[model samples]
Target: MKDIIILMFRLMVCIFEIWMLFGFYNNFLKNKPRKSRNNIFIILVFALIIFAINSIDNTILNLICVPVVYFVLAIVAFNGNVFKKLFGTLIGTIVILGTELIIVAVLNITSKELIESSMVNEPSAFVLTIIVKMVTFIVFEIIKQFSSKESEMMDGKTFCLYILTPLSCLGIMFSVVFCRIDFTENSLAKSVLIIFFFCMLIGNAAIFYGYNRYAKILVEKEKNRRTVMEQKMELESYKKVNVANDRYITLLHDTNHHIKTVYSLLKKDKKDDAMNMLSKLFDKYEKAEMIEYSGNTILNTILSDYKEKSSKENIECDIFVERGFNIEYVDEIDLVAMLSNLLSNSYEAAAKSDMKKIRIQMFMQNDGSFSVIKIENSYTSMIVEEDSVLKTTKQNKEFHGLGIKSVQQIAEKYNGWLSSTWSDNVFKSVLILENSMC
Candidate 1:
């Protein structure tokens, strides 16, 4: 009966540890509930393994086994980057183990014999286990309150910096707990030392929580900066379109003078020159004229502006648009801003490439459920990518990199998405927007 009771207590501790691990994960990683049965089963199998490992009472084996098992659990059952999941597991392990160590250290300070006997007594061990687990639970709750649900990528330096505090604190904890120092004779000093260790444990959690808050503030500031820049670009685009409109109106007012010059050349018996003059007039007219690229006026204006810029840069531009297709669901300013960013990037890329060509294709899908905008530009330079997204190769990276991100944000606003790929000296970007027309 005593053996059964001990086994039950062990099982209870195992279950509690698992619960605490899950709570730690919830602060950072998400469970893969889509495959609920598989996840639960995998966790159960690992729990049993952990329970068996704990029963062996081998310190070295348990240390090696727990982290390995949790790493596996993270990979199979958690939804996050592998590194983040592992980090979460490591933090959980440290908190639980550190709490146990400090509690034991404190118990030893009060009575060394009590600490030693707790190892052999099931009830004493049970009480100690409950104390450690309860403290761990409180620490986990404190962390969860400050944990950001949004998964932000941490750079290597920042990750190292944030993790250093907890690691150093854990080391200090180990040294304080395991060092050859007897505090049994000094009650006041022991009490103070015990309070200090507890504070250190909580302080480790506070460091990560502070990191989360700091990261969130940086993210929000970046978002605000991008918003401001995009709005400024939108206003600039609108101004340029207005300038183009005014220029076209001036060209229209000069039509009579152009016609008379061509007629005068013909009358002067210079047939070839007259033909050349007429050709120049037609070219000028075509340059200023806005081709009906799509049923959307904002799209047409943006395309016309970029097309003119492409001509000035000596970049070949080919644009094909299906007539009568429109995206009225998107706001005018957003549509203009998105297309401007995409075309601007394409123009810059094509201008620097060997081929110097840009092609744009816009059409409604067969099912009339979506509209597609595809931009392809040739490039000879190297493409820098991070996390599968293109990084800007321009010197002014601060402003340049936000172009693709802004395009993506605007696309997503209208139930749309953007994808880009580069190969064979050509880079292609495709934007898909749900068609409200149907």
Candidate 2:
């Protein structure tokens, strides 16, 4: 009966360890969209396999087979590259081995004879396993809090900063754990030692929780900065449009007088002078007509501004918009920012290319449920890309890449996405928005 009870405890520990590994993988890597039943099945299968491997009582075999099983499970259940999955598996394996080693090392120091007893039927061995599993669970929970679901993209510097606290705590823990302190007959001292270890674990978790909060504040600050910049740009564009409107109103007020003067010139046989007058009038009207591309006022202004800029660079623009189409879901400032950034990128890229052409097409999908905006431009050279993101090839790299990122943020803000592709010197960008009515 005692043997059976010990077996049950060991089995429970094995299953708990396996569950922790799965939790680690899910938190460390992006998980696939799996049904709960399927997820539970995968966990059960992994638990059974790991339990069987542990039953062999061979460290080498357990290490080799256990990580292999986890690696396979990660591949099946996660959505990341092979290297990322391998890295997650490696971390799990290390935690498993490290915690078990810490447990045995500490227990042996306290009582070598108690540590030497067979692990299967010894109550002390069962307690040791429980302690190890408890520590592992705490470590796993700390990691889960550190890696957030919204943004898993931690920079190297931040990752280093995040890891420093835990490493320091672990060092202190080990120094104290390995100190020469005879606790064989001192039950109170041993209990205090265990409580101290738990305190360290709790401290590490608290530190990481603080780090996550600080990271979120940094993210919010960046967003606010971006929002302010967008508003500034929108204000500038609207000022230009307002100036053009003023000129247009003045021109309309003087229309009758201008027409009479032209007719008078024609009557006097000053045909050349009349033609010049008409030409000048036409130039003024053309400038005033620039802001008439889209039904949305903000979009029209942005398109007009970019169109004029592109024309200065001798870049041909082939823009097509479906009649009466409007972007109803996005905010005015966001529309200006997103469309302006996209066109600015296209203009810069196309201006340097031999073809010197840009194309934009906006229309609702066939089902009328989605709005599609496609932009294509010509480029002479290969585009630079980093981590699957298109990087700016300009000489000044400091402030060039945020335009694409801004567009993506706005797209995602409105249940949309931005995608870009390039093939044979023609770069393409497609933006899709849900429920953007015409």
Whole-model lDDT values for every prediction: 0.75, 0.76
Which 10-residue span in candidate 2 carries the lowest summed lDDT?
115-124
In candidate 2, stretches whose alpha carbon ends up further than 4 angstroms from where it belongs are: 1-147, 152-181, 184-199, 395-398, 436-438
lDDT of 1: 0.75
Global lDDT of model 2: 0.76
lDDT of 1 by residue, 1-438 (tens): 768866765675676577557656856787777765665566567778889999899999989898888777777777889889878878888887888898777767865656454232444454455556556655665566457453454555776676666566555644544453445556456546545554665565566657767877988998888778768766877787787688788888988888898789888888899889788878887877887777766777888888888999899999988875667888776777788788988898899888999999988886778989999999888999988878887799876788888888888877899999989999999999988767
- Residue-level lDDT of model 2, residues 1-438, one tens digit each, is 757755665665666677678768877677799787888788878887887888889989987898899899898888988998998989888888898898787767775545343322343344455566656766776566567565644666776776676666566654543443445566556556655655655566566557656877978887887888899889988997787679788999988888999999999999999999999999878877765666777777777777877888898988888875558777778878888888888898899899999999988885767788999999897688888888887777766677898899888877889999989899999998887553
Q: Over all chains combined, what TM-score does candidate 2 have? A: 0.64
**Cα lDDT for residue 361, candidate 2:** 93
Check candidate 1 and list the clashing pairs: none
Candidate 2 clash figure, as a count:
0
